[model samples]
Target chain A: MPKPNRSFDKSLWVFHVNTGSCNGCDIEILAALTPRYDVERFGIKLVGSPRHADALLVTGPVSRDMVDKLKRFYEQVPDPKEVIVVGSCGISGGVFHESYDLAGPVDRIIPVDVYVPGCPPRPEAIIDGVVKAWMKLERLRGENR
Target chain B: MADEIIHFVEIIIGVFLVAVFGMIFGLLTKGIDRKLAAHMQWRVGPPVIQPFLDVKKLFCKENVVPRNAVAWLYNVAPIVCLTSVIAILLYIPMGSIPPILKGYGDVILILYLLTIPSLAMVAGGFASGSPFATVGAQREMVLMMSYEFPLATTIIALGWKISTLYPGEAAFSLTTFTKYPVWNIMGPFGIIGAIILLVVMILVTTGEITKVPFDIAEAETEIAEGVFVEYSGRNLGLFYLADAVKTVVMASLIVALFFPYNLSTYLGSSIHLPSIAWNAIDFLFYLLKLEIVIFFSMTFIRVSVARFKVDQVVKVYWGYLTLAALIALVLIALDILL
Candidate 1:
């Protein structure tokens, strides 16, 4: 992994991943990016390409079908990066925890730096999740020296 | 031989200076544009230095080369794009400073140079070997073709008007245009024509920079960032710098063609400032002019409207923009005959 720095904290381009999301957490992520919440003020832009991403905003319980795709997408994000798993589903599979089609929580598939535990976390909570990712990055920056 | 060597060294240093200036100013303008756009939307935008931070972060990230990509071409493309844009800047006179390589090239040369960066980008997209990039590169080529006519027409029309009036000088040179201001040699119809050309130039500039409404080739939501899909880290950083510098190139071209008159030209008599001081003043004024041009052509228009469809982009550039340019050309001809 490349060492983190101040610039990484200042501008975090995130790529959203929906591993069988129910559209609930994804909508909240969208809402957070809206003009009202405007995560852009913090320089948290949602990029289309995982290659350009500084963080992966993963949502939903990882299904059997998505497990491979999730790992591929995670590897695509360059170093000095973060993975913020949004919603309870991604952390513990939420209501889908007992479902037979599940591969399990997001962190079980790949490492997660932050988790926002809500059925569908609010925009404020999502923003907090991004902020927490920044702190983790800042700590890495400190450790780098 | 000694003086020639000295002059060569001086030109090299000046080129480096301009490249640095172009990069910094371009990023600064992009930051300001974002801030203005944010405010316009009734939201707080990122800090003015956000682009600088973004570029820095991009540089520090890991460079990812796709397994299927042609690595050599992918790496060279960004460098080619950045260098070509900087080359164009060397030929562009800014704020009473004649282009460093002035008499060697002309506006016609600039028109050609302007295409190289886009071409380099298309080349990179194709080299990346992604289906998305391939589609993006095709759209970019088509977009480039459609915009080229109006862009050429605007420059040629103005160049024709200038050449006809000033038969003795190096008529094709940007120095000639700056010396003999385009607006000054116009009657009512000619002024109208010049104004129309100015509008066309701005629209062409919008397309040239690949901002919204004309950014079909790189539509992020539609095609996963299009040409830049495979690019990341240092490669993406270089592209960002190229983009920022290209914005400066387009804005400066507009300023050169239409609004070349500087502060010191009129103020030289009354202000009694040192030549260096006056030069500084004129340069600042030129920067102000560039910002205003960029704000309208790139930022304001992009924020106010939605992105145009690929077909609409072709139609606007080829159909509407080209016709308007031709009408302006005819109007200028009428002015000349009268």
Candidate 2:
């Protein structure tokens, strides 16, 4: 096996996109920014635009209507990017699994580097997922570049 | 002439002490803002000593300037910002100063000096030649243009009111204006003018200091720390210090002009202390009042509202504020005639 890359371990820019879920997950995502969770100390930024982002932090189940928008957004992000499924809903549609409009577990539609498991994972866990995604990105970038 | 010379020396010393006071309050106000911002989000903030820790660490860090940066100006930007902010402190009437540089307190002079720090930062940003810094400098230029009109109007309205009330008199000096403060407007139109002036002053103060809702130049999410993006270590720290000092200076201006409450009278005007001691106490009173107003007014607005877009900010000043100021002028004129 080829050696793994780790350069993306330095800083990861996260872009958060809400699909279709209750605000519980969204609140926790912002909680990651609070003093206790303070992610800026690590150089991780919650970017407002996808173009500058290095990772996609998707929350909520992929809704049928949002499926195309999500794909378009993912396309806009530059290559050597990584995707993280941040909530159980994003992983397998969770409670919204039974909804008629449910499109997917995001991994089915996009290549996922890490799956952060929780109805809403603790911010530390989300940070871990991002770190793992960065590891995967570093590996890919090392091989390609 | 001898008395004037003695008074001038006293004013110089008074201004130096006030500058020191402004720096101290700048740091404390930042601590308070951080504590309050944390409380709003339901978390206890860092200890009040946190800002001190941050500065200490920044000082110890290795400094770096990008290879493309204009070496000389890049090194000079933060110093210019800091010096100009301190210079502004001299013109602001915090208390009874002995009158050194008293002649420099023309409202127009004070207004122009207020622009120097930001203008210096812009020059510094462009000199850095970084893409993000360039964008930040451009945004700052737009923001300054947007806010300056309303700010100018607020000053003019205050000057106009004093002129109308007293007639043909230039009561534009900080010491003179604060000495004879306008507490309330007597008539219906006067009240309207005063209220409008008060609101615009509050908004413009927030704008001039580049606080949130007006902080587009350093919008982290959009442009990645903006003009200061290229600055690191001590250079960055100086800009931060200048920013904190500007907050106090801007707040003091608001209080000196609008909320003119004097503390010496409360202690009994008959009881006199050393001139320095009296000035010190008055300075403290001015700071306390400024802190309360900034916390209750500007910081509250900063935390509660999301930032407006650049064009939106421009439209607000030109469309709403400019018209509001014009109305205030007409009302003040009416107060004079009838």
- The true-versus-predicted C-alpha distance at residue A104 of model 2, in Å, is 29
TM-score of chain B of 1: 0.99
Count clashing pairs, candidate 2. Answer: 1
- Clashes per model (N, Cα, C within 3 A): 0, 1
Docking class of 2: incorrect
**Tens-digit per-residue lDDT, A28-129, candidate 2:** 879888778876445465765454456788888888988898997787555456788888998888998878888887876777778988988888888788
Per-residue C-alpha lDDT of model 1 across residues B1-338, encoded as one tens digit per residue: 99999989989999999999999999999999999999999889999999999999999899999999999999999999999999999999889787899789998899999999999999999999999999999999998999899989988888888888988888779899899899898889999999999999999999999999899889999999999999999999999999999999999999999999988889899889899898888899999999999999988999999999998999998999999999999999999899
Residue pairs that clash (backbone atoms under 3 angstroms), model 2: B11-B100
Error of 2 at B83 (Å): 0.8
TM-score of chain A of each: 0.97, 0.89
lDDT of 2 by residue, B1-338 (tens): 99989877887778787677767778778778766766776666545545554555344333567779998999899999998998887777665542346676677787899889989889988998889899999999888888788888878877877876766556687765776676554377877887898888788878788878888888877887788777765686688789888988788788878877666756746887876687778767876888887885566888799988888878877878888888887887788779
> Largest DockQ belongs to which candidate?
1
Tell me the spans in candidate 1 whose CA falls farther than 4 Å from its real position: none
